[model samples]
Every structure is written in structure tokens, then in C-alpha cells.
Target: MELHHKLRRDPSWHPNACNICGQLGHQAVNCTNGTINWRQIYGDEAFTIKPPVFWSEMADKQKKKEVDVKELARRAREYARMQCQAQGIDYDEMIRGAQVFQHAPEQKPQLPVTSQQNGGSAGGAVKKEAPEGDLPEGWAVARDAQQRVYYWHKKTQKVQWDKPTKDTPVS
Candidate 1:
């Protein structure tokens, strides 16, 4: 039998054609035919091709209403309060914690370098600065208050603060 006949006989065989341009080989949905002939589709002779309006252009043309910042904030607080009550948590504490993170300044720490001549390790014994405040579960110490440093932990799970000391060996 022929290759096309064999393919047709296959259970998974599907016809491929560009729906927009009426072209073969490619699927219909992803047709790159930019020219949308509305007249051809609708059979309306009055219809003509017009320049496509981008999402941004359409948004720009729309009349925007001024938003009240204070009102929006009040509504957001009310919503948050309801959510917190549903989840059984302090709303004020959650807001305060969020504010602390929002207002906190960004800090980056420099790694300590060791001198080879001083008999020190090649990559200096880097001492990790202690965390400033007791953050909530899953939250990490972004900035240390004592040495004024920042650290990032990719894990979203909560870590035990009072675990093994720095002297403890890792298995």
C-alpha cells in the first residue's frame, strides 16, 4: 500500500490545513495568515480589511477613571480582615509584618576572603550573620540587623532556628 494510504488507515490520522489561509500541511489554529478577509468569511461585500488594534492602543483609547488610593486601601484592609478572620489569624500583625518587609531596605553581604600566606583556608571561613527578627514560618532572613547583611534561601518550607550550632558537623 502507498504511504499516504497507510497514514490514512492509521487510527491517529488527522487532516492538516491552515483555516485562515485555506493552505495545507499545517494545522488550522496556528495559521500565520495576517490578512483577515472578513468579506470572504461573512460574504459581506461592504466589509474591508482595517489595521489591527493592539491591546495597548485599545487601552490607551479607553477612558480611565481616577482611583481613590485611600478608599482602595480601606477596601483592601477590610478584605484582608475578613480573610484573616476566616483563617483564624491576627489581621494587624499580618499587616504590620507585610509593612516591615515592604519598607525594609535591600542589603547584600560580601563573602569573607582568606589569605593563603596566613595559613587560612582558600575560601575563608565565612561566618553567617544572625537573623534580625523572628520571621513567620516559610519566611527567611533577608537582612541581618547585627552585621547588616542579606541572605536568600530558595526553600519555601520553614526551617528550625534552634538547630545544631555552627560547630555541628553535617552528615
Candidate 2:
């Protein structure tokens, strides 16, 4: 008892209590109580402990949603088949036509057609023939596959869609 009293009286002798749970025998850094008594540690401000998130449960829910979507798709297909049968339409042919329409290339609006003798080109471009000797010096006229007339300046190596005359800039 004297040795114990002496040891307790020693300056190095100290007792440890957890700042988290206010329990003896452990410091806050070494606390292992699994839960902290916040009211005992931090004066009386209310605190709520949130539950831990489980990623596996979230992944399971996502997989279940995917299965439900697949089931809905199957039901829709069966309903469509029944409707087609009632209408006397071939279901497979109708499905194939729908898929073809979905995957088919888009169509472009068509231009009006005119006979080639009327200056209509193969590519639907309307062209007019320029009179010979109408081009300025160093400029020559050429026709594209569309029969569209284009002008080229030989000295500048410049090409233009419009016929180049003396008033056309060199550039």
C-alpha cells in the first residue's frame, strides 16, 4: 500500500480517460468502444449518426432494375405480336420493316428535273452556256460534270463559279 501510494504520488503517474466516450482505461486516440458518447464529450449540441452506405446493395438494386426493364420489353413484344395477329398482319414482317425504317439512311429532298437539252446537268444543277469569246483575256470557261460553268484565271491559277470578266478582281 505504501508503494502504491508512492507510485500514485509520482509526477509521471497519470490516469487515462477517453475524450470520445469519457471512459477510463483508454485515451481518445486508443478508443475502441465502437460508438462515441458525443453528449459526454462535446457539451449538449444535438448530433445524429448516419448509417454507413453499402455499395453491394446499390449494385443489386441496379441489376434488379435492368431485369425489370428486360421483362417489360418482353411483355411489350408479346402484346405487339397479339395485336398484329388480330389485325391479320404478319408480325415478323412488320418487325423487320420497322427495323429497316429505323436503320435506313435518310432521304434528301429532290430537286426538280429538266431535260439535258434544256441545260439541266446530271447532278441537277441548272446551267446556261456562255457565248464564245465573252471571257476576258487569261480567263477560260470550263464545265463540271453537273455542266455548271466555272471560270479560271490562267495567270493567277484562281477558279470561280461565276464567269470572270474584265471587271473581275485578279484575286
Query: What do the candidate models score in CA lDDT, each in turn?
Result: 0.54, 0.69
Instruction: Name the regions of candidate 2 deviating beyond 4 angstroms.
Output: 1-50, 68-71, 109-171
Candidate 1, residues 39-63, lDDT tens digits: the string is: 4566753545677889987777673
Error of 2 at 30 (Å): 36
* Candidate 1: 10-residue stretch with minimal lDDT: 144-153
Worst 10 residues of 2 by lDDT: 5-14
Backbone N/Cα/C clashes per model: 0, 0
Q: Cα deviation of 66 in candidate 2 (Å)?
A: 2.5
Query: Model 1, which residues run further than 4 Å from truth?
Result: 1-60, 65-74, 113-171
Which whole-number lDDT from 0 to 100 does residue 12 have in model 2?
45
Query: RMSD of each candidate?
Result: 16.5, 17.5
